[model samples]
Target: MIRIVILLVTLVIGSVANINAQSKYEQGMGKAFALWTENKPFEASNVFERIAEVESEEWLPHYYIAMINALNSFGVTDKEKLTLQLEKAKKHIEEAELISPNNPEIIIIKATINTAWIAYDGATYGMTLSMKNAELYKKAFELAPDNPRVVLSKAEWDMGSARYFGQSIEPYCKDIERSLELFATFKAESTMHPSWGKDRAKEVLKQCKG
Candidate 1:
């Protein structure tokens, strides 16, 4: 009877341990995603670091960390600071790719990291990185063609690239027209989409003007 009781108790403890572990993993993933989606990268990075430690096999944490690092790199105008963050982002992104090579989101994120470099290089090297930026944005667009957010972001990047490449003077006006057209298209499509509505679209349009 004691043996039977001991065995049952062990089983219950094992089950409880498994549930706790799964709960921790899920909570970590959820927090990481929430922080990232909210654009709170510093907070997201902290959560992602915890997730990475807890679930090394899951690539999302590494991917988010890479994205945050890339954004931070772009936020700075200092070349050395930008390069250091870019390298860090590259490392994390490479690890994520290793974990999930075929993941579409990972591909887009890899392209995002490249965009930061493109922006930085543009500041330092004139138009040298403009083509590179266009190429990465195109790759991202191809990778996630159906995602409304991705489509909108790609169009915006193209508009920036057009200006950076000095194609903005068509006589000057044509580039502006194209940029406005793309922005309008994105605004309409993103706003009307069932999942994402008009408010964010209006904010984006306001940004375009300013």
Candidate 2:
């Protein structure tokens, strides 16, 4: 009876420790996200990279590292700097893929990174990068057709294409609207899970309306 009681106490202590660890991780992620939402991608990326280094078993940190790099690359005007950022984004995304190969979020980020490269210098890398980006997007959709992040990525891509070609953005606006609806109802599997892209979808939806 004493042994059983001891075992029960140990289990309870272990569970509490686990809960505290998870809460700490969520707090770190919240800090990173706050920086990201404030348009501090460089700082957010650093936070994410640190998290990835410490939580080698998790894929979300690596995914966010790639995402922040990709988002920051857009504002970079220096060709050399942009190229380096894109490469870093690609490397981090690849790391994320190793951790979660079938993850829709990782797949969509891969598509986004490749698309960013094409947008950066289409004259030199357009054909191949565009093909690869489209393939990644298709794979992501196949993997998780109902995922809000996947739908948002596709909608954003369509909006970019429309703008590049000087075409109407109305169709893509509808896509964004649908994605926002999904985002509203979407439930993440865990607090540590990827639950971004909703705010981004709303931002793009506003731009499309504008």
| Highest TM-score scorer | 2
Q: Please give, for residues 37-132, the per-residue lDDT of candidate 1 as tens digits.
A: 554656867887777877878786687678667756655778788787778788888888888775555655666666666556646544555555
Off by over 4 Å in 2: 1-24, 34-39, 162-173, 199-210
Q: Which lDDT tens digits does candidate 2 get at residues 12-78?
A: 2222222223466666777776665555657878987888888898888888788667755654568
In candidate 2, clashing pairs total 0
Q: For each candidate in the order shown, give its overall lDDT on alpha carbons.
A: 0.55, 0.73
